[model samples]
Target: MSLPFKTLIKIERGNHLPMYVQIANELIKLIRGGKLTPGAFLPGTREMADLLAIHRKTIINAYEDLSVQGWIESLPRKGYRVVSDLPVIKPRSFQPKNNYPATSISPEELLHLPAFTRPGMVNDYQPGALIVDDGFPDINLTPYDFFLQQYRQQLNSGILYTLNFQKEEGGLLSLRTATSSFLNQTRGLNITHEQVAITRGAQMAIYLAAALLIKPGDRIIVSEPSYFMANQIFQQLGAVIHRVPVDEEGMDTNALEELLKTGTFKLIYVIPHHHHPTTVTMSTARRIQLLTLIKEYQLWAIEDDYDYDFHYRNSPILPLASADHDGRILYIGSYTKLLGPSFRIGYLVAGVQIIEQAIRYRRLMDIRGDFMMESALAALIDNGELSRHINRSKKIYAARLDKTTELLTSSNIPVSFHKPQGGMALWLRFDPQYPLANLLTNASANNLHLYGTAYFEGYNTNYNSLRFGFASLQEQQMEQAVSILAASLKKK
Candidate 1:
């Protein structure tokens, strides 16, 4: 039976997509929506062309595409029919609905009360305004031309269909393998491709890991000044968060051990290398102690090493996952920091079983990742471009860090900060006389933007500090920014 192909398939002549490809995609959607059942015969090329008022060659091309994708089969005498072997999917209306009403049910009405509050909208700065972001990479340093070349190559490769429709929720095998090798060589992690699941970013990796391990009423330990977003994720999952102090040695393992003795906790979230907000690397002794505690208490640990590549000082201490023998650590890292926040690519490394579970959980939200970008990144890693970029970035960022530190110290702003061993940002604390809120207001008036410190404040501790991101600013811009900050501080 010939369905109403004219009514079902609305071709957009103005769309940038080719008419043939659009028709093929529409047909596939109809088939999946059950309008065209298995073994249902389709109109011949001429008939379909006449029915749709398109060229016969266009109809033939669409049909051929469908056949190549296994959505349809051509019979000797019967023309084309939907493939009988296609899996039966739940049917939904294929027609586009116009002016659908907003959802009437509020989240609080449908689910548990006290639903997670939405975070404030991001501040939109003027185009030329200088922004002191919270540790973002300098996008100008990205090897985008090389990345684009690899992206084009992947798109034109013989495996284009496979790259477009890969079924692995964990991600492209090539990227995962390359990531496995890169981590092994650079971070000393003993992991295989099977132990890695690519995520949108480290944030998603953290969410997936938390989803896999956390349940309501479960206690999770975090440093006093922890990553707020991670804490919010745990809270949204109904997990109670406990705080341990973070001294110069990192999350005081002694304090955590003492807390562990007091109560049972499901997981510990630590940023051992370049700890967020404070930019303090956990001491080697503390890392060992934390790992030992994890082993002794049979607790899970999430080591978020987001900015491990830009360490300015001596060789970066190997991540906790590098020494994880029993699969206790779920290590997360991101290419966003290496490239920029705009590039959303990260991975979670754990045991094979843990990664398998993470992949399954990830599928509930994201079916698959960007295979083309992942493939391009794989090419970059395979060729030494990524490492070379990191090497160059370290020197550039190290110099900027020095310049910013020198300016801030020499200025009469009355601020104190430790020279970080590694990472992109410097943690600066102004004297109590200069309230961060007031400083932020004054900075804004001077056309300078700075991130707020309220998120880093804890129940009992108020850190009057902000993470001064120096990587994104050059020497002159840093000078201008510091001058603006000094002017802001001088305000009555």
Candidate 2:
């Protein structure tokens, strides 16, 4: 289909940026400069290419690239058009558009798109929907009104107004001290505030830690079939990630030791306390071995303690940091699973020197994340509200995990998993014959959202596993969710 593009763009073929990218950038500049208004139609690729004496494919490539990266849109028979939701980067000084209030953008353009493995199923499950999915708390247990009251009190307080752009290391007075005290009591690690760098969440903390340590051509050791997102992050940073296979006792220290002797690794990321997708905790002896290997190989051990707060059985073991003789471990934790996602608070505790370096890198990536929430978190900690809330949340999570595991075991589903002492996820390994592609498709048909096992180093192995977050599901719904999941795989 042919359409008209009225805008003009000057592309420099010799620029360091690629030809297509240069074209995209010029369009971006026009949009930002307000020369290209929203809803304006653009020229067809072949026509524009003919006018500019470039290949039709080049123009098409530029348009496709921009659309993919969330700049423009293509409508059938209407050529490319400037995104209606685009925000103009108005001139700051004396320009009327500078005072132009911020306009809205759609969820399609923004990065915060929900976790939709399938393109069209995100809105399939919703609050108050009649379905067996993990969305809200069990209405029978906690009072909705009580939580509202506490939240309202926080809003009325002075915490919201004083979101100072404090030290890049994180909030100093309230939250920092609380994090130190909480870790000391819960994890048995005696880290000072200076050693702790609070973050928007554990994911960001991991990114900062990885960025601080990793660069192009550096080697990093990871568990085979490990957390796909973490692997993706490390991969994006250009580090060569070496995947070491795991067993029932968390990360394979012996395999790592052998790998270390043969190759140099800049970082080794592990979920030692209760691993993701595998649900295995590293034995203390293995922990010692890992620490020894860290010193022997001179590599940084990044321990992602994502769900240590919820241990159903005996007390949760102190994380690797509790046993670190040297300052090589950067223990990470977050409150997303426990209280709620809105907290957006996570912390990394390391030696004072490492914290300093991480903060410098953090500032560059994003300056002072969620200052108001951070300050409120500090207040919550100082007043012991945070501790109390976590303790209560832990019991609730423990019950959910127990019920879910019991149900899965009773069903005799062709799945077996080591019950993690702590953590919210249940890592289920299907029979060797089960293929992930089929399971995902069938599961979605039954209105279930299941992720693959690759995130926990399950890529190379034929093991079919999935991590289920029990902390978020209603206790009654876990049985149904599991049954649907099990049936989906069986049918496939």
Q: Which candidate ranks first by lDDT, i.e. highest?
A: 1
Model 2 poorest ten-residue lDDT run: 91-100
> What would the TM-score be for candidate 1 when compared with the true structure?
0.74
Which regions of candidate 2 are displaced past 4 Å? 1-121, 126-169, 451-459, 490-492
Q: Please write out the lDDT profile of model 1 over residues 1-492, one tens digit for every residue.
A: 557789999899996447997798788779867899898999989899999998999999989867755678899988999988652212121122111111111111011224333122235766678888888889999989887877676667766776666798998899999999988777777667988899999998988888888878989999888887888788888889999888777889888889999878989999988998688989888888887898899898888995887776676777777774367778899999999988899999877777877888788778999887888888778755676577667768888988988898898788888999878888888777777777777788778888633443448665768888999988999999999999888433
Candidate of highest TM-score: 1
lDDT per residue as tens, model 2, 69-118: 44678988777888875422111111111011122111111012124253
Q: Which portions of model 1 miss their true places by more than 4 Å?
A: 1-124, 452-457, 490-492
Candidate 1 residue pairs in clash (backbone atoms < 3 Å): none
Number of clashing residue pairs in every model? 0, 13
User: For each candidate, what is the lDDT?
Assistant: 0.79, 0.66
TM-score of each model, in listed order: 0.74, 0.69
**Cα distance off (Å), candidate 2, residue 458:** 6.1
